[model samples]
Target: MKVLTANRLTNGEAVWLAGDHSWAVTLQAAEVALDEATEEKLARAGTAALLKNEVVDVALIDVELDSGALRPVRLRERIRAAGPTNRRDLGKQAELQIAVAA
Candidate 1:
């Protein structure tokens, strides 16, 4: 599977593209693309968002269902989904179960 992701231009916060076509703050809310059509659609949306200056570093990442939850395939993506590592209280993105890759 895949998930669309980017950094919100305003705040540089990692965000996921939701099924409803909205940008979500957490990975759990991201829309998973299980097929090529959905992936293409997501890619278009990401491109539009980028052109509108809504986000940056748009990309699709590979992912898998881990214990019934979304898990990013790459270490960098895992870190992004988990939020900052320095502190647990600030900008922490809930539990790992709550939230990617293209």
Candidate 2:
């Protein structure tokens, strides 16, 4: 599968393209394109978001459903999704851990 991602303009938060043409903060909520055609359509929508100044650095990324969890295929994307690995106490990973603990 493929997914579209970018950084939100206002806060620079990593975001994914949602089904309704909106940006989602979490990958689990991202819209997945099962084929090249759908990926192209999503890329166009991402371009629109960029032109409207809603996001930047928009790109299509390969992903897979690993044990029911959607994960990015490349290391760079994984870092982007999880946040800074050098600082485990920061970003999405930290937030997820906190949520799990609660």
Question: After superposition, which runs of candidate 1 have C-alpha atoms over 4 Å from their true positions?
Answer: 94-102
Per-residue error for 94 in candidate 2, Å, reads 1.5
Every model's TM-score: 0.86, 0.93
What is the alpha-carbon lDDT of model 2 when measured against the actual structure? 0.92
Candidate 2's residue-wise lDDT over 15-71, tens digit each?
A: 999998889888888999998899999999999999999999999999999999999
**Best model per TM-score:** 2
Candidate 2's TM-score: 0.93
RMSD of 1: 5.3
Clash totals for all candidate models: 7, 0
| lDDT against the true structure, each candidate | 0.89, 0.92
lDDT of 2 at 38: 98
Model 1: per-residue lDDT, tens digit, 1-102?
Answer: 999999999999899999998999888899999999999999999999999999999999999999999999998998888876776544635443343111
Off by over 4 Å in 2: none
- CA lDDT, candidate 1, residue 57: 97
